[model samples]
Target: MNAFPPAQALSGRRPAVAVWPWPIALGLLTVFGLLSALLGQHGIWLALSWAALSLPLIVTVICLVRAWSRPSDKGGRS
Candidate 1:
């Protein structure tokens, strides 16, 4: 077995913020987008809906990239 752990395991690097922010932001965006959509179908409402719908996708991509970049211990411990 390997005696040493990955650099991140030794260094104890962590995300600066908690996981809640993304979901909360996403929820707010969705609500706002829905409200905008309900009120109108053109102008700012359409723009808002598009931006809001894209947020979760953006967050997912960012998280996936981060996970892929981090080194794993190969044993699935991290």
Candidate 2:
């Protein structure tokens, strides 16, 4: 017999939360900002809008890279 109980019994499972809203909102903002910049007349407004749109994207990329570089718990599990 195994010393450890079955994995399923060790932890209670819960429904996952939907986490795509932020990314979706950011993507929509970027698309709208770019479209406005291309079709509208204000040059400074366009630059500012594009810069604002880039902030979330940059943050997301940094988070993804950090997560990818961190050590996983693969082999540590029995």
Best by TM-score: 1
TM-score of each candidate? Answer: 0.60, 0.52
What local lDDT does model 1 show for residue 76? 32
Clashes of each: 0, 0
Lowest summed lDDT across 10 adjacent residues in model 2 is found at 1-10
lDDT of 1 by residue, 44-68 (tens): 8889888887887888898777667
**What C-alpha lDDT values do all the predictions have?**
0.69, 0.63
lDDT tens string, model 2, 1-78?
A: 113334543454423446887778778778877777777748887886788678778877887776566556232122
Index of the highest-lDDT prediction: 1
Q: lDDT at 25 for candidate 1?
A: 87
> Residue 37 in model 1: shift from native, Å?
1.7
